[model samples]
Target: MKYYSTNGQVAPVSLEEAVVKGLAGDKGLFMPEKIATLSKSTIDGLKDKSFREIACTVARAFFGEDIEPDTLDALVKDTLSFETPVVPVRKNCYSLELFHGPTLAFKDVGGRFMARLLGYFIKKQGLNDVNVLVATSGDTGSAVANGFLGVPGIRVFVLYPKGKVSPIQECQFTTLGQNITALEVDGTFDDCQALVKNAFMDETLNNHMALTSANSINVARFLPQSFYYFNAYAQLDRMGKAGEMVVCVPSGNFGNITAGLFAARMGLPIKRFVAANNRNDVFLEYLNTGKYTPRPSVSTIANAMDVGDPSNFARILDLFKANEDVHKAICSKISAYRYTDEQIAQTMQTVYSETGYILDPHGACGYQGLIDSKLTATETGVFLETAHPAKFKETVDKILSSDIEIPAKLQAFMKGTKQSVELDKDFVGFKAFLLRQ
Candidate 1:
């Protein structure tokens, strides 16, 4: 399949080129030239299929022409070692638990898929010293670092804001000593993201090392996320509630929801979408006023959703720009709601008290978006529980007045001593650091 840059400044490239070159020359996200729609019968038949079968079907749509069938099937099977179950939390409401992976975050789906795909391309071309640059708010660092850890010929540099991420989230990546190296930047998530983008466009850095991103900005990372959306629909289809299904996403960088938009284009039968935002609500503002103004992000209980300038917003705009009235095109299909730290805390407490269901701060936003949504009696809602509540155990414990049990996966990470290289959030300094390596 041919992939086109959303900015339209470059020629169309193959899927391999799109995956390897993370960002376009014009600083746009890579978008597939064609959105292949599945047959209605195929969509209805998904309920009877396993997650691997459903994922292979969807993966075939995006990558079948580029990759051989058996190789692609193996990649899908290896990437998805766990199931993303849609659990019932309330009447007509469900939580698509995505925290079952190694990192216990939704980015695991994309991160692992991208890692295997990149490794395949590297080995195919006999490449060497392929450096992956990823910027994280909180969970992304852990997801990407753990995903690419120990992969031959690939070195992962995880740049994250210092003292911003949760202690548990920090341990997951910083403690993993392998091909992964975490860079502690003394700034916000936007600063870390800027450093990565700057490194990608720098001619000197590109000449020095093969630089690529594992952030949602990468086509390989975010596109694979659509697999879970199809799986969620299949799970809902089994319950006879897929007729008027509304899926709410706890959105941060907009990549997760962008994948959903891609799934909808590919005929997922979703009624519409709701984007849940924390205090850093740039996308929500765009939905309300049609003005996309990005500023500095503020720290919140739901640290993962704390993104001010989302890179995928460009792709969202470009996706709708091709149709009539860009703003109208997007607003018609998406509804957005923003929440404060207090509101997020209230949700985590109330939901646990009422239903005995734990909600992390990010998932709280998604759950509340559905609660506020004026859905019809027959409409069913599924909000993505993006991460495990224990990830932010300090905040979750304080809110619920209880100490949550940290899973063995997280506990193992905490046992190791952290090793990181601290740096200022400046491009020149970052370039010099990489040049030294």
Candidate 2:
């Protein structure tokens, strides 16, 4: 399938070019020329399939045109080795637990898939020195770093704010030694994202090395995320409770929710969406007033949702504005809500006390969104539990006043010593450093 730049200035390119370039020459994110819809029979049959089978079916639609069927099946199966189970949290509310992969965060699915896909492309094209530049507020850095760790012929540079990310999130990336470099930038998540975007646009840097992003801007990274949504539907269908399904995502860079939107567009039967936000509520502001004013992000308990300028907003805008009323289309399908740090903490505490389901700070935003929206009695709501609570051990412990046990997977990352290169968040400094490397 041909992928075109959202900006509409660049000509369409093949899957290989879109995956490799990550961003378009026009500085716009890539969008597929077509979104394939699954037949009713196929959608109904998903209930009998495993997560891998459901993913393979969904994967074939987005990727089969570009890849041989067997090869694509293998890639999908490998990327989804773990399951994203929809556990019932309340009467009709569920938690799509996505923190089951190596890094135990939602990005693990996209991060791992992009790593393998990029590896395949590099080996096929006989290219070396491919650099993956990612900027993360939290989980993304750990997920992408662990996903590409020790992968041959690829180097991942994780740029994150110096003192913004939780300690566990920092450990997950900084401790990895082979083929993964952590860049602790002295700025916010937006600053780190700017440095990565600028690096892609730099003439000298591009000439020096092959550069691509693992951020949701890359189709390879975000498209695979649609797999779980289909699987979630299947899981709900099997339970005989696949009523009006509404998904609430704790919006960060908007990649995760954008992927869900793509699933809905592909006829996954998603009734609507709710975007949960923390203090950085630019997207919510956009939804309320129909004005997109990007601003600097503020620190919040839900650090992962601390994105002021979400990169995938362009993709969402393009997806809805395709020959229709843009604001009306988006507003109709997506409800927006924002929460304060106190509200997030309160939700986490209340959910734990009432249901014994531990809500990560990010997931707290999602849970609260559904609660605030006042879902219909027949609507089945699933909020993405984006990461394990232990990733934010300090915050969780403080909020609940109870010590939570860290998972063995996270403990392993913590055992390793930290190693990172600190740099000023200025683009000039970032460019000079990349050029030297």
* Model 1 lDDT per residue over 205-321, tens place: 999999889999999999989998999999998888899989999999999999999999899999999999999998989988989999999999899888999999988887788
lDDT, candidate 1, at 60: 94
Question: Which regions of candidate 1 fall more than 4 Å away from where they truly are?
Answer: none
Clash pairs, candidate 2, are none
- Compared with the true structure, model 2 gives a TM-score of 0.99
Query: lDDT of all the models against the reference?
Result: 0.93, 0.92
> For candidate 2, what is the lDDT?
0.92
Per model, state how many residue pairs clash: 0, 0
Superposed model 2: Cα runs more than 4 Å off: none
Model 2, poorest ten-residue lDDT window? Answer: 320-329
* Cα deviation of 321, candidate 2, in Å: 1.2
